[model samples]
Target: MPSTDSSEAPNEASTDASTAPWDVHRLPRADGKTFLVTGGNAGIGYFVAEQLAATGATVVLGSRDADKADAAAASIRSRVPDARVRQIRLDLADLASLKASAEALRTDRLDAVVHNAGVKFDQPPRRETGDGHEAMFGINHLGHFALTHWLAPLLAAAPEGRVVTTGSFAATSERLDLDDLESSQDYRPDRTYGRSKLAQMLFGFELDRRLRAAGNTVRSVVTHPGGALDSLTPPRPPLHAPTTGERLRGLPAGILVQGKEAAAWSAVRAVLDPSVSGGQLWAPRIFGLRGTPRLRPVRGHLADAEVAARLWSASRDLTGVEPEFGLG
Candidate 1:
């Protein structure tokens, strides 16, 4: 394994921080590294996988749809013919399937695990997943929580392992209800989604603290893809382009929302940038809407230790996937 550990300094010479917030072109070669990206079939996840693969890293795209995964892999290959990439079946909405996918992963030398899969739209008629939790919360927070717990040992095995969880601006105004994470008593789609994102933020920061306390090298980082417009995603042949109406809608969004490719920069930076340490939050430098990605301060409730501890405990109890190394 590589000798890189938490003590090693970042390859600062490779990426000039003064020139830009993050430049994928300046990323150091990841010839022997491996990364896993959930929901890599489309949107920002696909772009993240593509960027990692472009850096000569072995990227494992995780998605529920086998066909879409294959297409995504093929699309990456078409862009970077020599890109090393593969796919695995991972349904974050389904606990059993998610566990099975984690068990099937080749975790002996994983460098980073990017949790990017999520349900953005508020699916009305709030429903619970197979694990008996709210669908959005289950898929967005609980599912990734379980997967990360299961894969913690593997991440620890790597010299500079990282777990990158995608957060959202919505978390800024939302409060996670630990006593009722599933929103059992009351369920509003938007608030439920906001609470779920906040949960993810809490988990990422809490996990980093736990890893540090336990003297582990693994890093848990949180990032947000600011207003990534889906219409601007890379076109995969045979896949229809944005409709006329969608294009028209994208016109205004184009000004406010960054393309999926650019939006992926935050997550990619969190995982690959050696300067980025555990518990750091990275997001857009603009109005939390679109612009260059940069490291941001964790403020207000985001830095609340009591809430984070409660979330960590509640996650372990709910998922039943106790981390092998992160628990202190």
Candidate 2:
């Protein structure tokens, strides 16, 4: 099992063999690899997809909106002239549609999958998914859970497959109520959102444990984009066009927080860095809010085996999809 030590040092191999820090602008070549970035049409996800595409890998943008996905793909192609990008319609809110989405990949092996898509409501009027679970928890946690189950075989076929789950800083202060996984009883928008992300992070950590026990080469890595602000983000035309006023107002916050592009570094690094091991948590270097990506010790409830195991069981029961690891 991976270490749970809070004081553990960052992995020395996190840097390249030349002892130089990992540079996001110049990623190592991944010509033959295929990566999927959920919600790649906008925000940090778009930047993650763009960065990965720069390495000559085929990137699949998983989004419910076809037009947006097309536009995002176009943007990537324009930026990286040789980029190879595809799109697959994925509606996480509807459980029945995911198997088809997984099948749409049209490839036998998937190198890595970045679970960056999520839903967060800012106001009242509690919502539920098509499956009758809370929207936030259902889409953010359960949807990915089921999708992973269907994609297991394709992942296992890879030489060294990876499942990179994008977690959140909001999850750090929250705890999961496994008894009320869906928050059907007491539902506050912010709290529910936090709990949903917390559940996802828990699932990521627990998944690494199960992968190890199953003797699977596929690794599960978790990452969080801390304090990403749209105003701080660079415009991606129709997807994200921040006004000058918005950029001016966001400058002060940029000192501690960062734009979506910077936020993409953690997940991108987690996906591409050869030294990043399963069970490690990658985040920004400066107080985890902004800076270059680096390894952060897995601590607190994230390292709680008992809670993670319970959450894993609850997730399996709720989704009714058992991830097939092939052996143990």
Candidate 3:
């Protein structure tokens, strides 16, 4: 096993705080590392899975749709030639679905788990997932939350155990609803999505705190693809591409990603960057909110230990995925 925990500092030269975060030439991942990416069938999630495979890591694609998962694995193998990516069935919307996925995968080792699958939309009427939670919070946040809690052991077993959950720029828009999580009264799609994202990010902070408190070595970190991203958006979104995506299709402009290929770097860096010291977040660094990926500083709100603990307790109560390492 590798000697360093996820929170440990890397080799001296790798600690260059001055380096830009979003370089396309990704740093090589550790040999024999394994990663599982949720919603790896298409969009940014697919791109992240593809790049990780290209970096010589075995990747497991977790998607709700089995057929789509098969197709996605085929597409990636075609592109990367020797890609070692597999597919697993994981439905975030249903409790039984999530439980079945966990039960089926009895594997005890995973270096990293990236929670990149989520939904964002503008629906006329409100909807809830099979679990009776609001659409955005249920599927986007709770689904992944439950899944991650189940996978915690596999992550902790790895030499540099890490979990990277994807947050959105939307998280910047709204604060969490400690009082009313589901927004049962005022169910606005946009706000719900933002709240869910906030939930995911907050979960990362809480996970880190719990790991530390329990004397566990697992490291928890979060990453966002940026405002204008092709790779990280949900596969089912109506606006998968930027409305003006065609206009931005010219040459590799200054800091923006021209395509999904370029955008996957932000996530790749988060998983493998030896310099990343746990709590620091990663995202693209440029205007139009797309392009140069960097390990930008995250908002302090995420680091609020009080809010993190509250969110953690709420999540466990809601999903019932009892984490092995208890913080309280």
Best by TM-score: 2
Estimate the TM-score of every prediction.
Answer: 0.90, 0.96, 0.84
lDDT of 2 by residue, 1-328 (tens): 1333555454734545565668878888899999999899988999999999999999999999999999999999988988999999999888889899999999999999999999999998899998999999999999998898888998999999999998898998898887888888888999999998888888889899999988899999999998899999988888889899999999999998999999999999888888888898988877888888878878888899999889888888888886766843
For residues 1-328, write the lDDT of model 3, one tens digit per residue: 0122333223222457676533456557455788888998887888888788888888999998888888888878877767888988888898667766765655678888888998887874778887798888888888888887678767777888788888877787688879889889887889888889999888887777677778887778887777544433323322244444543454344244345555566677778776655765766655315664555555467667788778878888998874554443
Q: Candidate 2: give the clashing pairs.
A: none
* Candidate-wise lDDT, in order: 0.82, 0.89, 0.73
Write candidate 1's Cα lDDT for 107-161 as tens digits. 5878999999998655678888887888888899989998886677778889999
Query: For candidate 2, what is the total of clashing residue pairs?
Result: 0
Candidate 3 lDDT trough over 10 residues, lowest sum? 1-10
After superposition, candidate 3 runs with Cα above 4 Å error? 1-13, 16-23, 229-258, 326-328
Candidates, ranked, TM-score: 2, 1, 3
Number of clashing residue pairs, candidate 3: 8
Query: Which regions in candidate 1 have their CA more than 4 angstroms from the true location?
Result: 1-21, 326-328
Strongest candidate by lDDT: 2
Candidate scoring better on TM-score of 2 and 3:
2
Indicate whether candidate 1 or candidate 2 has the larger TM-score.
Answer: 2
Q: Distance from true position, residue 243, model 3, in Å?
A: 13
